[model samples]
Structures are given as C-alpha cells and as structure tokens.
Target: MSTTTTVVDIAPVAEVQKLSLRAADPSESKPEGKAPEQEYRYAHLLPHFSEDRYPPLEPYEHVDPGHRALQHPNPRSFLDTAERVIEITPQLGTEVRGINLAELDSDGRDQLALEVARRGLMVFRDQGDFINRGPDFYLQWGRHYGRLHIHPTSGHPRGYPELHLVYRDGKQSFNFEVDDSITTTVWHSDVSYELQPPGLTTFFLLTAPPTGGDTLFTSQVSALKKLSPQFVAFLKTLKAVHSGVEQAEFSRNGRRGGTVRRDPVEHVHPVVRRHPVTGDEALYVNRQFTRRIVGLKREESEAILRLLYDHIDKSADNQARVRWEPNTIVLWDNRVTAHSANVDFRHLPDARHGARITPQAERPIPALEGLDLSA
Candidate 1:
C-alpha cells in the first residue's frame, strides 16, 4: 500500500502578502481549562494650575463690535445654568459642564464663544450624544461664529470641505505610558500658512484610544504676557512673514501631497498680535510656519525666531494637555494659542479620529499704542 507520487511547487517568500511576524499562531492559545491573565494598570493625566501663569482671569463678557450691550441683556445668566466651569490649567483650557454643546441655542452659543475667546479653549467631555451627529452637526454648531474654513491642501472628507479631519491611526501598537493622539507632532498653529489664519478651530473626538493621543496646547496669551515688557515692546515693532507654501504642499494627513501652490499666500504681521474683539495680545510667530522676521538680517531673524519657537514649545508652565475621550469637543482659538499633538503611543491599536472646523479667519493686527524697538 504505497502512496501515489505527487509534485508540489513552493511559492517564493516575497509573495507572502505582509503578515506580522510577531502575531501568535492559531494554536497559541491557552489550554482548554486555563487562561492567561491580563495585569491591570492605570494612569491619570495631571493638570497644573499655576497662579503665576494663569493669575486670575475674569469671565469673558461679549461686547458687540459696536460696544453695545444690546445683544447681551442677561450675560450673567450664562454662568448661572447647570454648567460648571473648571479651570484645568491656568494657561488656557477650561472644562465646562452643565451646558450641552449640542443643544445650545444662538444665545447659549454666543455666551459659550465668549468664554472660549477668553479661555483660549473650552473642553466638553462626556458628550456621548454628539458622537453620531457627524460633521453636519459640528458645521451647524460652529456656524454660530462664522463659516467653517475649507483647507485647500488638507482635502476635506468628501463633500464636507468645511470640516478638516484630524483622523489619526498611528502605529496600532500599545504601551503602558502614552498614546499617539495626532500625528503632526510639532508646535504649530492649525494653519498659520493661510493668508487668514483660523480664528476659532474646534474638534470633536468621536473615537479615542485607551491610553495615548493626548494633545497639548500653549497659550500665546501667556507666551506674550510672560515676556518682559521690554521684549514685548521690541516685538511690537517687528513683522514676521508666515508662508503658506510649505503647508499648502502637505495633505490633510500632514504628508507632502495634493495641489502644491506655486506661490503660497504670505502674510506679514506683527509678532505681538492683538485679538480683534477682546484686544488681547498673542505672540503670533509659530515654530512651523513663521519663516522670517522682515527687516532683519538672516542671522538675526533665525535667532529671534528660534528664541520665539523655543519659548512657545517650552511654555509648559503656561500650557495644558488634554487626554481625549469619546465625544469630547475641544474648541481652541487658533488666533491666541498654538497646539502640538503628542505621538508618544508607539504602536498601539489605538485609533483617534475627529472632525476639526476652523471658523472664519482674522487678519492678525498688532495694537500700536506705543511701539518702540529700542527701549
């Protein structure tokens, strides 16, 4: 009883179609009666409140462009609601409760925007209802301010050009320490490259990882405030050129792709930019886009820019980190703060996807009360 002769052709190893070598084999599970146990570990993000950095901020009250209080009859009624405002960090961000962002009316939105303008950003956690509402909800929600911005390079998701996507699926691996929130791991404004930088940029975290992807935001208000009056006086006399060329070359995913603008729009604005409504000053130069300081030598420009960049990145004393959870909305004023997405999550199966909308744009202008370069 001999077996029939057979011939088999083996395929080349190159054609195995990319499988993870570390993946366990089909038979690698525990025996029928035994199971492996997962060790429990937990961590919490600490929010720092520095008196020197935050001092004490007054609640923002909306004053109409005409400086009339007609639009705000019962302004104090906003804080009177069930909403509780918690100052997570003195630098900029605040966590607000008792008010449902998804259910706010025109008046409620206006009051909310006031706090957002004053605080730099307002974070709404535990917003499960808004999870499936999609971009349409956010578009209408943010429309209370102005039209949502459409990025020319970062291709908007399908028909929603107004909604810039901050969807990240970085290294689907894991760690006990940190998670990779957003891939653009740099200290930069949302779109300083634009002729009109975003005034208000809001994001809703629909999906969040278990441990990583914490975003960090620095207060330009604090950045400017901490500087010596002499430095601010010097900065007021200077103009920095923010180039859109490099940014327009990259896709929404932060890679170099899409329609490369031949000559990206360039805007020269003072380093100390004043908020149009509140008249608050923010150090406008960012690490990524503000290329040069006009009227200065190359060396001088580099030195000054490097110093500013370092200051923005190192303003941890005046910065806050947000550990995102599902249905969390972070509304940050791009006009007043710079943000950096931390990618500390190595390769966790963690996925962080969100919708970001930039509401309107503002031409950065410096308040010229008394500008003297030489003190």
Candidate 2:
C-alpha cells in the first residue's frame, strides 16, 4: 500500500520522533518525575480542548500494535509477570492481577498489547497506585505504545491535550430521544472514522457511583466467527464508509461548545478487518461511526449494517461486562472490540468521571483472502 503524506500539523515531526525513540528504548520511556497531585473535584465542568484551527489531514501510516508485537523478542510470555490472569469469558475479557501498569517495561507493555489484541479487553482492578501516579506518568505509559491521539472534540483538562475527560453529572437531563437502553445507540470502537484509528485505549475510572456504571464489551472476532462461512466470506469482500460528520457538528453546534480542532473525517475500511497481532478476522463496523457499506445502495447498506449491528447486539455469548470501581482501569483494543457504557448511573447522585488515553495505530487493513499480509 502506498503511504500518504501526513498533515504535519496533526502529528508533528518532533512528536513522532520522540515517541519513536521511546518505543525503541523502553527503559528511557518512563517519565522523569511524578506529577503534582490533582483533585477530581472538577468533574462537573466540561472543558473543551481545541486549537484555533485544524489543518485538513490526509492518510498516513504507522506500525500497528500487531506488527510491533511481532517485533518483540518474546511477546507471548510477558504476562508471566502478572500474579494472575483470569479470563472473564470464553471469548471476550480478561482480568489481570498483581501487575502495575505504571511499572511495566517495554517488553511488558508489548505483551500487554498483544494480550489485548488476542483478547478483546483486559481489566485491572484496584489501580489507585497507577491512577495516583498522575497524568504525566499515565501519558508517558500511553506514549510508549504509540503516538497519542488527541480526541477531535472531547473535553480535556486545562493543560493536557492527550487526556480525554469522561465527565458526567447526573443532573443533566437526557439530551436525545430515549433509546430505552444506552447500548442500542452507543456500541462502538473509539474513533473509527480516522485514517489511522485508535488501537489500545486506557480508560481509568476515578470516581463512580457505588453501583450501575458498567461497560459492555463485545468481541468482534467472536462475532464474526459465529456467522456462517458463506456470510463471513461475503463480508470479507466488502468495505464500509465511517464518518465523523455527526461528531464534528455536535462539537460545533451542540453541547460540546465548538471544541473541534481536527476537521471531521470519513474513510472507507474493510467490513472485516484483520487483527495485526493475532492474524484473526474481526467485524469492524459499529453503529456510532460506520455510515454504510461502500458498494451497496442506501437500502442495501442499511439492511446489511442493521443485520451486523443486531448480530453484535444479540450475541450474548460474545459479550462481557465490566462493573466499575474507583481506580479500576480497563484496557481494550479497538481493533477487535466495540464497547458501550451503562448510563443507568447518570441519574444517581454521584458523578461518573474517568480519564481516557487512546493511541492511534495503523490504518485498518482489509482481511482479503489470498493477500500477502505477512509484510
């Protein structure tokens, strides 16, 4: 595939160089000093982090997590450092214990990435130690994997552009028509509209209501496998268009108060994408961003997408749920999973707030049969 020149403004050369050097030498990737402690008292304020103008972007390339995992001399064994790794379900999530994410070396990080690639999501509990290490340490840990992605319109803390704030106050009335369940409209991978979409996302819950704020993760790999062979084959031959126009418009004229720095984008991606590390096929379209299948008529695309979406929604065996607690961190690979939050806690007195750091990975690769993807 030909490489597209980058809009240097989106990802600066110096920034890319720094992340590259860090990836090459994991020992040097650790942050120098602990960041001053910050209180989570400001959960109610929705602060938009945006630049004055965002230059238009063209497609660019980067080494994806799968390729990077393969480069690790021993990617599979890094999990041996964990005290215990428990599979949450036959197909979807894993709960890892006794591993401090802030302390993982390069090899450990690589293996963790590999594990998330293979498993849809990994949950680590009682992560207050890592969470308290502050944004500086957290950001550095994310950068070690890849160049961090700045969310086009999400609220960020005052100085940190890399930290996307997930703040919710229970008092705000419902903004849209009631769906009866949030999962109906919210199941999605993070930012699928980007040329190079997000790979691994770190979501750390800092505060939570005592109950009712759980996230549901669906394994696209498993979702695809459950289909009949003929259907899967047909899906492989198709591409879908994912768009960011709704999100951009929301940022500009909706509740976000015009926080968009990067222009909203749209791209065509394989309906079935190949996992970079595991060499597995996954259903990639989500209800949130995926607009339509490229070659189909409007009705045909809607029918097909609706079928896939319903499959993902009803495949109970392919899903896993993570109940949240303060200081719990869930790391998920967007390449293989789609997730949604249970907004049930939104009506509770307590606020639901968290910090998310998503690192961009390679452009989606079509899992075309007979293609030499080994390169």
The sequence of per-residue lDDT tens digits that candidate 2 reaches over residues 1-375 is 001110111111112221111112223434568533322333222244445565665555666555666777777676676788899999989998777777777777877888888887999876767877777886898886677887777766666778887654444321221345534347888889887888988997655666786889999999999999999989998888888888888767745445678888888888999877788899999988999888788999999999999999889999999987555789999999998877776666565556788888888888985533221
Evaluate all candidate structures by whole-model CA lDDT and list the values in order. 0.61, 0.73
* Model 1: per-residue Cα lDDT over 164-225, one tens digit each: 65433343211111224333457778767555667766776444556777888989999888
Deviation from native of the Cα of residue 108 in model 2, angstroms? 0.8
After superposition, candidate 2 runs with Cα above 4 Å error: 1-46, 49-51, 65-76, 173-185, 369-375
| Candidate 1 Cα lDDT to native | 0.61
- Model 1: lDDT of residue 289: 80
Q: Which candidate is the best by TM-score?
A: 2
Candidate 2 lDDT at 289 equals 93
What RMSD, rounded to one decimal, does every model reach?
A: 14.1, 11.7
